[model samples]
Target: MSVKSAAAKLFAKKIYKKTQGWSSNPIASQKNVLNSLIKEAKKTQFGIDHHFDQIKTFEDFAVQVPIRDYEDLKPYVEKVVKGEENILWKGKPLYFAKTSGTTSGAKYIPLTKESMPYHIEAARNAILHYIHETGNADFVDGKMIFLQGSPILEEKHGIKFGRLSGIVAHFVPKYLQKNRMPSWETNCIEDWETKIDAIVEETFEENMTVISGIPSWVQMYFERLQQKGEKTVGEIFKNFNLFIYGGVNYEPYRAKFENLIGRKVDSIELFPASEGFFAYQDSQKEKGMLLLLNAGIFYEFVKSDDFFSDKPRRYTIGEVELGVNYVLIISTNAGLWGYNIGDTVQFTSLKPYRIIVSGRIKHYISAFGEHVIGKEVECALQEAMEGTNARVNEFTVAPQISPLSGLPYHEWFIEFENEPDDQAIFKEALDNAMRKQNMYYDDLIVGNILQKVVITKVVKNGFQDYMKSIGKLGGQNKIPRLSNDRNIVEVLNIK
Candidate 1:
C-alpha cells in the first residue's frame, strides 16, 4: 500500500475507537454533550435569558427553553447580523449559512468558530468510518470531486452569508485541497450551469476516486460526462468507487445512477443541514444513519403527529422509540436552543440511535386528509417503477383541489428519463402503491370522496426548467415532493 493509504487506514482506526463509545452508551454520551454545550453558552444573552445556570438536567433545559422555529428566533438572528456579541453564541459568528425559507425570504443560520469544527469533523468521520468498516483506504490516494454551490459569499454587517455547502468548501482541509476538484474560481461562479460546465472541463481526466453531492446534481454531472465522451461514467473515471450523497432521498435516483455508472459502487448517506451535522451512515450493514450522539448538538424529538398541537410532548434520546415518526429538535453549540429545523425523522434502530429521514415538516400532502409524507411518495414511486423500465428524472406531488370537472385528487408531475411502455398501467400502479401504503387514501377513494390520482408525464427537463426559472436550480434546492396546496403546481403551468 502507498504511504498515504496506510496513514489513512491508521487514522480511520483511531476515529472508530474514539466514536465507538457513543454507540455503547448513547444516553450518557448525549448527556455529556448537552452539558458541555450548556456550559459553553451559559454566558450568552439567550443563555442568561433562559436561566441556563439553574438548568442541571434535560428536563430543566426543556422546560426553560420552549421549542422555536426560524421565525420565532429571527429577532435574535437579526441582532447577530448587525454585529451583536453574545446574542446567541459567545462573541460573533464567523459566517451565516443561508437556507431556503418557508414564509420568510431566507434564513441565516449562525456558523461560529466553535461550531464550524463540528461540521468539518462530522464529514471527516463519515469517510473515516466508511474506511474503517470496509478497509478501503485507496480512495485517499486519488482525487475527490464535490459538486457544491457558489462560494462567493455576500456580506451583511461584516458577517458572511452563503449556502452551507459553499461555506463548508471554504474550510476544506489544506491537505485535501490538492486532490479536490473544481478550482476555487470555478466554484465561485453563481450560475450552476456555467459552473458545472467549467467543472466538467477541469476534472474530465483527473484520477477521481470519490464523488460527493446531492444525487440529482451528481447525476447531471454524470450525464454531461457521458455526452462529452460518449462513454459511461465508470469508463470515463475508472478509479471512481465511493459515492457520498445527502440533501435528498437516494432511492428514486438509485436505478438511474447505477445505469449511468454502468455498475454499482459503495454509497453513504449523511444527515447534514444548515443547522448542524446530525448523523452519518457508519456501517454498510445498517439501513439508516447512526445519530451523532456525542456531537456538539444535543437532540430532542417531538412526535410528528403531535407537532401541530398546542403543547407537543418532547422526548429525549432515552425516550425515543423505534419506528416512530418524530420531528427533531436540537440545541447546538451554535446557540440554536430547542430549535426545530422542520425536518422529520424516524428512529429505525434505538440501540445505536439510527434514523431515517421521513420528510420535511412543511412538505406533506393533506388536502383531503390523506396526510402523505415524502417517505411514502418515494416508496410508492419506487414500487411503481419496479418490473418496468421507467426511470424518474424528477417529480413533484400536489393536491388538485377545485378541479374543473371531477372530485379532488392527488396530481403527480413526473419527468422520466425512460418512459414506461404503458402510461395508463404505470399510472394505475402508482395509485395502487400509494393506496396500499396510506389507509386514509384508500378509504377516501373507496368512499368516493376523492378521485383517482392524476399522473402527468411532463416534457423532458420540465422540472429543471421550472427550477431554473425560479433561480433555484442546484445545491440543496429541490422540488418539494409533496405540497399541501397547488401553488407549486400552478407555477409549473401543469393544468
Candidate 2:
C-alpha cells in the first residue's frame, strides 16, 4: 500500500471507533443533539418566537415549534437572505443551498457555521465506516469522481448560494483533492451535457477507482464513458470497486448498471439532503444506512398515514418503531425547526438505528388507496429483474384512472437497457413481485377494481428527453418514482 492508503486506513479506524460511541447510544445522542440545538438557537429570533428558551424537553420543543416547510418559513428566510443577523440561527448563515421548488418558487436552505461541518464529517465517516468494516482503504489512493452540480456560487447580500453538492465542493479536503477527478474547469461547465462530455474526455483515461453520484446521473456518465472508450466501465477502470450514491434507490438501476459496467460493485447508499446529512451505509452487510443520531440534527417522525391528519403525533428517536413508514420531520442546528423535509423512511434495523429512504411523503400513489411507495416499486422491479436479461434503464409509475377501454390500472413507463426475450413472463414476474410487496395493490387487483400493471416501453433516452424539455435535465433533479396523478404519464404519450 502507498503511504496515503496506509494513512487512510489509520484515519478510518479512528473515525469508526468514534462513530461507534454515538451509534451504540443513538437515543442519548439524539436527545443531546436536540438540547444543544435548542440551547444554541434560543437567542435567535426564530427561537424567541417559538419560546425555545423555555423548552425543557422534546415535547416542549415540538409544542413550541410547529412543522414548517420552505414556503412556511420563507418570511424568516427572506430576512436571512437580506443579510439579517440571528433571525434563524446564531449570527449569519455561511451559505444558502438553493434547491428547485414548485410554483411557490426556489427554496434557500441555510447552512449555519455550527451545522456545516457535520455535512463534511458525515460524508467522511461514511467512507471510514465502509473502510473499517471491509478493510478496503486502498481505493483512496486511486482516482475518485463525484458527478455533481457546478461548484460555482452566486452571491446575494454577502451569503453564497448554490446547490448543496456545489457548496460541498468547496470543502473537499486537501488530502483527497489529488485523487478527485474531473478538474476544476470541467466541473465549472454549467450545462450538464457539456460538462459530462468534458468529464468523459478528462477522466475516461484515468485510473478511476471510486465513483459517486445519483445512479441515474452516474448511468449517464457510464454511457458516455462507454461511448468514448468503447469498453464497459469496469474494463476501462479495472480498480473501480466502490460506488457511493444518494438521492434515489439503486435497486431498479442495479441490473442496468451491472450491464454497463460488466460487473458488480459494492455500493454505499447515503441519505444526505440539502436539509441535513441524515444517514449513510456503514456496513456492506446491512440492509439500510446507519442513521446519524449525533449529526447535530433532531429528528421527529409522524406516521405517514396520519401525516395530514389534524395535529399528527411527532415521535422522537426513542419512540420510532421498526418497519413502520413515518414522515421524517427534523429540527436542526441549521435553524430549521419542526421542518418537514417531506421524506418518509422506514427503520430496517432498530438495534443501532438503520433506515431506508422509504419514499417522499408527497411522491406516492394512493389514487386507488393502495398507497404504493418508492421502496415497494423499486424492490418489485429489482426482484423481477434479478438473474434475468430484463435490464431496465429507467422507469416511473403513475395511476391510470381513465382509459379508453377496460378498468384503469397503474401504468409503468420503462426505458429498457435490454429487452426481455419473453415480455409476458417479465411482466408476470414484475406483477407478482408487486403483489407480494404491497397487499393493498394486490387487494385492488383481487377485487377486480384495477387491472394488471401495463408496461409502456419508452423510446430510448425518452426520460432524458422529457427532463431536458422541462429544463430539469440534470444536477439534483430526480423523477418521482410514484406519482398519484397522470401528469407524468400524460406527457409520456402512453395513451
Candidate 3:
C-alpha cells in the first residue's frame, strides 16, 4: 500500500471505534444535539420569538415551533441575506447555499460556522467506514473526480454564495488536492456541457479511482468518455472502482451504468442537503444510510400519510418505528426550525438508525389513488429489468387521466441506450411489476380504471434537451421519478 493509503486505514480504524460509541446510543446523541441547538440559538431573534428559552424537552420544543417550509421561513432568511446577524442562526451565516425552485425563486440556506464542518466530516467518515469494513484504502492514492458545479462564488450581503456542491469545493482537504481531477480552471467553467467536455479531456487518461456526482450528470460524463475513447469507462480508467452518489435512487440507472463501466462497483449513498448532512452509507452489507444523530441537528418525523393533516404528530429518535414512511423535519444549528425539506424516509434498521429515502413528499403520483412513490417505482422497474436485456438511460412517469382513447393510463417517458429485444413484452413486465409492488395500482388495473403503462420512447438526448431548454442541464439536478401531473412528460416528449 502507498504511505497515504496506510495512513488512511489507520485513521479509519481510530474513527470506526468512535463511530460505534455514539451510533450505539442514538437517542442520547439526538437529545444532546437538540439541547445544544436550542441553548445556542436561544438568544437569536427567532429563538426569542419562538420561546426557545422555555423549551426543555422534545415535547416542549414541538409545541413551541410548528412545521414550516421555505416559504414560511423566508422572512428570517431575508434578514440574513441583508447582512443581519443573529437573525436565524446565532450569527451571520458564513455562506448561502443558493438553490432553485422555491415559491420564491432561489433559496439561500444558511451554512453557519458551527454547522459546516459536519458536512465535510460526514463525507470523510463515509469513506473511512468503507475502509474499516473492507480493509481497502488504496482509492485514496488514485485520482478522484467530483463532477460538480463551478467552484466560483458570488458575493451577497457580507456572505459568499453559490451552489452547495460548489461551496463544498473550497473545503476539499489539502492532502487530496493533487489526486483530485479535472483541474480548477476546468471546474470553474460556468456551463455544464462545456465543463464536462473539459473534464473528459483532462481525466480520460488519468488514473481515476473514485468518481462522485449525481448519477444522471455522471452518466453524461461516462457517455462522453465512451465517445472519446471508443471503450467502456472501466477500460479508460482501470483504477476506477468506487462510485459515490446522491440526489436520486441508483437502481433504475444501475444496469445502464454497469454497461457503461463494463463492471460492477461498490457505491456509497449519501443523504445530504443544503440544510445539513443527514446520513451516509456506513456499511456495504446494510440496506440504508446511517442517520446522523449527533451532527448538530435534531430530527422529527411525521408519517407521510398524515403529513398534510390538520395536526400531524412529530416523533423524535426514540419515538420512531421501523418501516414507517415519514416526512422528515429538522431543526438545525444553522437556525432552521421545524423545517420540512420535503424528503420522506423509511427506517431500514433501528439499531443504529439506518434510513432509505422513500421519495420527495411533493414528487409522487396519487392521480388515481394509486399513490406510487419514487422508491417503489425504482424497485419495480429494477425487478422487471431482471431476466431481460432492457436497459434504461433515464425515465419518468406521469398520469394520463384524459387520454385520447380508451382508459386513462400512466405514461412512462424513457430514453434508452439499448432498446429491449421485445418492446411490447417489456411494457407488460413494467406494468406487472408496478402492480405487484402497489396494491392500489393493482386495484386500478383490475377495476379497469386505468390501462397498463404506456411507454413513450424519448429520442436520444431528449431528456437532456428538455433540461437544456429549461437551463438546468446538469449539476445536482434530476427529473422527478414520478409526477402527479403531466407537466414533465408533456414537455419531455416534445424534446
Number of the top candidate by lDDT? 3
TM-score of 3: 0.76
TM-score of each: 0.76, 0.76, 0.76
Error of 3 at 469 (Å): 35
The alpha-carbon lDDT assigned to residue 181 of candidate 1 equals 86
lDDT at position 254, candidate 3: 91
Q: Compared with the true structure, what per-residue lDDT tens digits does model 1 show for residues 67-180?
A: 999889998998998998999889999899976444445678999988899898998899999999999989898999988877888998888988888999989998799999
493, model 3: CA deviation in Å?
16
Deviation of model 3 at 347, angstroms: 0.4
Cα RMSD for candidates in order? 13.4, 13.6, 13.6
Model 3 accuracy (lDDT, Cα): 0.87
Native-to-model Cα distance after best TM-score fit, residue 364 in candidate 1, in Å: 4.9
lDDT per residue (tens digit) for residues 299-392 in model 2: 9999999998889999988899999999999988888888988788999998889999887777777655455768778888999898789898
* lDDT (10s digit) by residue, model 3, range 195-279: 7889999998799999998775687789899999999999999989999998767775699799999999999999889999999
Q: Which consecutive 10 residues in model 2 have the weakest lDDT in total? A: 98-107
Weakest lDDT window of 10 consecutive positions for candidate 1:
98-107
